[model samples]
Target: MTTSTHEKRPNILLITVDQMRYDCLSLLGHPVIETPNLDELARTGVRFDHAYSATPTCVPARAAIFTGQKQTSHGRVGYQDRVPWNYDKTLPGELAKSGYHTQCVGKMHVYPARSLLGFHNVILHDGYLHHNRNKHSVPMQEHFNEVDDYLPWLRAQVPGADLLDLGLDCNASTVARPWALPEHLHPTNWTVSQSIDFLRRRDPSKPFFLWMSFVRPHSPLDPPQAYFDLYKDADFPDPVIGDWAMKEDPQGSGLNPVTSKGLVPKRRLRNAMAAYYALITHIDHQIGRFLQVLEEYGERNNTIIMFTSDHGELMGDHHLFRKTLPYEGSTHIPFIVNDPGDCLGLDKGNVVSEIIELRDIMPSLLEAASTEIPDTVEGNSIWDLARTNGKALERPWREYLHGEHAQGMDSTQWITDGWEKYIWYSQTGEEQFFNLAEDPGELHNLMDSPQAQERIHYWRSVLIQELEGREEGYVQDGRLVVGRKPVNILAHLRSNE
Candidate 1:
């Protein structure tokens, strides 16, 4: 492929889904979920097989996306609400500064509920955030009715309609149901519908940066009746349970509806899988709708579309349900970039195996727009890797990535170099090592294997060095410390602005 030149900067469309697993796409050989639209999009550009969210939670992962910084730079290592998003630079904000009309159509998941974080305007719906929904916060703009643009829009479509009308808990892993409302009223459809409206009304004089973020395949497990029917009878594969997991929670899914780790009953798990797969297919079709609009509007070829997720839902992998785990089911996410106009001449249909993280999105997109990347941004642009099919790079690439979450189950610190991964529990000092090249499902623990001891020590030292000099005292005298209390936001980020 050769670079193609254009008189004007290409429009950027970033499509983000919540808690979508890397293995869920049929393009990547997923047996159940069908994502024809996403697969088609991938064929137009490049797909990354090893993309990850360092923190693997909504708040922290999104912080990395917006700020283009790692957990250390952004000061958010875990899921927390109400922390002000005061980053000096953001992806959408930077694009707006560079003369693009930027708008976000769905979930921001930021503090203050209404913080724009650099987009010129945002049509927000941050799912069911408990922090903003609490009674004390209701009087403020944090309330859903005040800050969620979707709520008002939904109400206008159908009087007295509420997202919670079905009474499903937002985080319930075992829950599954068909949406009670009309299919068009679903949040997935609304995101694309509103995005098309934005494209229609956008200022034609300048290029646009539209973020069509979807808040589905996350929870409530409620797909429209039609989508649910598509998968209700399909047989689904059982969750991969590591031998280590059974030792920890022998009771399994029997523990609770939302238990993070357990052997959930087959019936409930199957129902949840059906609903989850249905939600994904629905989103895929909605994306198809938006792409069609972009094409009909004569902007499809000139628009660059990138799709990814903040993190992956475990969905019973290793008996885990939600995110915040260092396992592949939680951290690994889908990342596909489609520059339909060949703006950067990216290798279409290329699947890059190099490890990339959420923070890389900012720098990559900014580079795509020919905008200056902020000096504070820690992630490197993935353009060269994508263009060269991960074989060559104009600049040096990271040999390994260090990731962490302040808390999940005793907090986690992990490192990976695409082919292998190492995880350490900060509080308990327990460790897990997986050769991803051999065991992508992570069904085996190599920590106790004598042959893996030396390699494990090398990875452990790397993590120790990465955590060295942190305020939390994660490392001392070149060794990882145990029992160090973790903070959701680091001291530097807490004091920053």
Candidate 2:
């Protein structure tokens, strides 16, 4: 197979789905949800079953994905925390410098709502909706204040849309539902339209790097009516680790404090799961539409498409509502890569079970574009996995993938090597271990089991070493400081209203 010079330089299409889980797709043998588009992408590309986020929160995972650095290295450790944008180099910025036309559409979640970082063109979609919830203010309040001129239009669309009646909140259960408005008006659809518009009108002279970020299945779980209907009668399976909390891992457990709330009724859990599935299916349809447009413009074959999420959502797993848990429910995310040449060494329908992280994406993209990856990046390039004649890569590439959640004093570190997994909780000084090969559901904690003591000690020592080797970038008064600005809690409160 002779490759042309133009073929060697592939256009990059990176699709990021917010709050999607590792097993949410139909291609992954998910029993209930129908994600034909994503499944199709997997069939034609490569599906990574063991891919994980460096940190399971939004901002930090995205920073890691873009910068090819760990959360500590990038200093964006928590949600809504101010990211150190000026300090690090980003993938789009590096690609743009290499002459690729970099474009971003939809949510990047950079602070101040408009940090371009590196993209040459950006279209903001779904501005800080749920993230607006602060102690004193919320995002809706900010929207109302800044978007008063657009309020009249918003009110006209839904006669009482602006009305804040706390009573209305109680009428609905936690089940996923269709948006009260038309699909075109929904934020996810709106973002997809903007991305389509950009792709349609984009200049073709330069190889392009486009980031299509979809915000859905995130929170306030809402999809359009048609999508909701798709799963109305579907019999959804229960979560593997249902309402069962494990012993806290001493290194740090990612389990949020809120998950301990009692199990939601079975029916309610089913409804919520169904709604979540519906939203995923809806996003899959939109992705299909986007791919159709790519084919329409003769760019499908030339574009190296990458689909992934910043982090996985709990979605009722372990009775958790949102992300931040170190469990597979929060850390593992769906990752698919389709190189331009269709030359990825793995079989067309192959599923790579080796563990990989979100940080690896930047270097992989650079390699696909035939651009040089910067030496500063901590991620390894997966170019060998995508090459036509490349060999299979080895596992435990970095010994263990580490995760950090430092919002509060409670911290967590997760170390996994596919079969046996260990989690350490710094705040409580507890350790949790699971024999994933025996109990993939993580129902049993073997941290104190005499039989697994040696494995536990090995992982604990590994975690300590990894932490010790980390560079203390910023320090103030004997504390390691990244110089992050305090988040405006009032701004979030105002947005909620």
Question: All candidates: CA RMSD in angstroms?
Answer: 2.6, 6.7
Model 1 earns a TM-score of: 0.96
The backbone clash count of each candidate, in order, is 5, 29
Which candidate number maximizes TM-score? 1
lDDT of 2: 0.69
lDDT of 1: 0.87
Q: Which portions of model 2 miss their true places by more than 4 Å? A: 1-8, 126-175, 242-261, 343-346, 387-396, 407-410, 469-497
Name model 1 segments beyond 4 Å from true. 1-7, 137-139, 247-255
Cα lDDT tens digits, model 2, 1-497, are 12344445778899998878888887667778888988888888888778888678777787788789876666655565433355347899899988788888877776644668888978765433433334255455444324222224445666665422222121122544557766776667766777788887776667789999876677556667887787878877776663237333443322222232235666666666777778788888888888898898888888888999888877656655567668887888898887546644446666766677988999988887777888878897765654421244554355567776654433566688767788866555566899888987788888668999999888877676666634322223433233333221223222443
The TM-score values for the models, in the order shown, are 0.96, 0.83
lDDT of each: 0.87, 0.69
